[model samples]
Target: MVTVNEAKQKIIANTEVLTSMSMKPSESLNYVLFQDVRASISLPSFRQSSMDGYAVHDSDITARGTVLEILAEAKAGEGTMQVLPPGAAMRIFTGAPVPEGATAVIMQERTTRTGSFVTIEDFPVTPGRNIRSIGQQIMKGSIALPQNILLTAGAIGFLSGLNVEEVSVYRKPKIGLLVTGDELVQNGSSIRHGQVYESNSLMLRAALQQEGVTDVEVLYAKDDLRATIDALDELAGRNDIVLASGGISVGDYDFVGEALQSIRAETIFYKVRQKPGKPLLFARRKQTLFFALPGNPASSLVCYYEYVLPAIRKMSGRSDYFLRSVSMPIERGYSFDGERDEFLKATANQDVVIPLDGQESFALRSFAIANAIIYLTVNQNKVEAGDHVEVHLLPA
Candidate 1:
């Protein structure tokens, strides 16, 4: 078995980044940029009003209670080409282009408009106040967004404001899920004496959705070598990444390892020296990467978060793929005699971290309430109260 760090390195090194594609900004959320996004035109291409106010020459407002002639009205998207005359102001709305000769804007609340004249009640009018200069946000022919940036809603909106319709981004990988276990039944299906509801796919799909991965196809394979092999072969051809849950451990029904071998997939690593997911299996065939997670619900989810999610993120061209980690003091002492390193479900606050019970691989009740995972190294089995521990914060 390989150490956790070694396994993670191997997975990252072997995984290939998907090719880039041109997509609309609306459809490119969560995708990493392949090229630098340069601004085609300057943001706020014209000097714009930032508020619904009066645009006036700064010199015109020499003192409080200054009166100026209302020249014209400039509404957003309907600015006039007429320049402002000296000692005159324009009724400008937010986002309207500031007329030439105007150096300042005063809020409507601070001014009293009477017919064609307006009185500025406030003193010391400042230049460039309440006005967004041309290219204030982004200069034309400059980098609006650097390469490798993850596209979020704000990024998309910014690009859209710059009139960028399409973006070149790393394509999201297509995924295939193979669940191996005859004892597993669908959630709505009638259960037999030995049957259990199949939830790994559901949990994994939801997790993948959180990462902005939605193109997933799920298939159920009976605990038979031939069936597992056929399913693996089919999924390998269809997806860039294939996740197979269960049938990885050395059990009578375990056939994932044998099936992968029969299909000629190269095993990068068979197991990792970690609790809850010790039997994790990683493999590859040509361009397709495979992860065979442990059977238990908590084990599968843990392995997915620790290993599979990183691989998926890398394939999609993300820069930071791992969960956020922080060091915190344990609220209470905890003792364990386990030989493998464990990721204990826990809740953490700014002050302390409290390890929760039901940490067994099959137990997920604690996981449901956990906001973090406390990493306990194999060599350090016992933790004293107030001792510092590394915690991996979960996504909210």
Candidate 2:
């Protein structure tokens, strides 16, 4: 069995970023940019008003009570082609184009209007006040967003402000999930003796979706060699990553490892020296990567977070593929007698982490409330109450 870090390195070495595709900026959320995005046009292409006020030349405001003739009204989206004459002002709304020769905007609330003339009441009248100049945000033909930036809502909005409708980004990998076990039943179905409600698929799918992986296909396979083989065969050709749950351990019904061999997939590693998911299997065939996770809900989810999520992030061209880790004090002491490294589910804040109960492979109740996973190395089995520990923070 390989160490967790070694297994992670192997998985990363085998994974490659997928091809890039041109998609609308709105549809490119969470995707990494393949190329630098340049602004087609300058943001605020023209001098714009930033408030509901009167646009005027600074020279026209001689004093606080200076009165100027109102030329015309300029509202948002309407062009004001006429230039402002000396001692003149234009009634302008927010986002309206500032007229030529205008130096400042006196907010309407600071002025009193009588007929075609308005008196400025504010004491200070500064030039360029309440105005957004051309290219203030982004200059035309300039790089608006650098390559490899993950497109978030703010990035999309900024790109949109630059008049960019589409962006070139690395495509997310297509994933196929095969859940194997005859004792597993779907939620809402009647359960008989020896039957368990299948939740790994649902949990894994939700986790994948949180990473912006939506092109996922899930299929069920009974605890039979032929059935598992068929499922693997079908998904291997159709997906870039195939994740199967259960049937990899040395049990009578465990056939996932055998099925991979039957299909001639190369096993990168069959197990990791970690608790809860010691029987994890990772393999590959050509461009397709495979992971056979333990069947227990907590074990499956833990393996997915530790291994599969990073692989997906790498394939999507992310620079930071692993979960955020930090060192914090443990609220209480804990002990493990085994040699394998353990990931204990815990609730954590900025200062400390509290290891929760129910650390068994099949237990997920504690995992549901856990915000972090405390990592305990095999070299040390016991921890003091206030000892500092490394914690992997779960995605919110």
Candidate 3:
């Protein structure tokens, strides 16, 4: 078969982004924008007060003890405020519009007020200090958010302040899952002499859910070849993607590889150069993508991040969807040799890297809480404590 890179390219080349509705601005929290967003109106459309203070022209306040008469009182949400004449001041609360000819603001805390007249306690209170200018936060006719920007609490607040009600964003993908193995038993059930609890499927399902996938249909099939193929064929038509655990290895009950072969499916690659996921399978037909991950939990997670996420992104109309990792200073490093590129489980304490107990792909216990991977590139195998490496971030 082909290399991992070749398989990924094949999958990318064969798929297309289906047209889907984007989330509205009111509901865009935690979603990615599909396109740039432009402001319909300038933020802070009118000059406003930043604090409870007196609006006065800077030229009018020359020295300490200088006094001015309040022309009008302004409050929050009050209607059209009249402009103040030269040397005149207005009583303004927070968020109140600054009247015309007002060049600066004298905070109420700094001014000694008596009736309508107020005395300035501090001189040289600059203009624009207490006044928020028009479009100070955002400009009119300018892009508010760029394409592929992930919406957050701050983004929501910004959009809300701009009076945005709707926004365009990508939707998450829907996936179907299947687990085939007679050696597997459901949780809380008594296991037969040779059977074990079915853990891989649940682990994979949880991973998908963490990726924002909500529409998931899970199925469990026996080792029968016909039964397995029939189940896959039915799921293929119903879901945009399929994830099959087990039945892809070289054993007699491993019918997934043969079933795909029977249907003339395009098997991108049946093996990886990695340890636990060496027997991984990838195939696709029309728009329905399928990934036959190893029954091992750690291996399944590796392949999921490596391959499954890309498929979900493509189906969701996201262009730059891929796994991301952060780098930190390695606390310890070694020069080692290995055939396949290794992704070791690691814990990061700020800039220090600590390898998890088990780095093998079959060690789910060690991999479960892993947040980052220690990327050891192929071929050469040696690193120092300060080496910068690549890692695949696991779901928290």
What would the per-residue lDDT of candidate 3 be over residues 135-251, giving only the tens digit for each residue? Answer: 998889989989778787899889888887788777665677889999899999987899989988778778776766777988889999898888888888788888898888888
For all predicted structures, in order, the TM-scores are: 0.96, 0.95, 0.88
- Per-model tally of clashing residue pairs: 0, 0, 5
> Model 3 Cα displacement at 127 (Å)?
3.5
Clashing pairs in 2: none
Report the Cα lDDT for candidate 2.
0.92
lDDT values for all models: 0.91, 0.92, 0.79
Residue 372, candidate 3: how far off, in angstroms?
A: 0.3
Q: Put the candidates in lDDT order, highest first.
A: 2, 1, 3
Residue 349 in model 2: lDDT: 88
Stretches > 4 Å off in candidate 3: 114-116, 188-190, 317-320, 326-329, 333-338, 382-388
- The candidate 1 region of ten consecutive residues with least summed lDDT is 73-82
Per-residue error at 348 for model 3, in Å?
Answer: 1.9
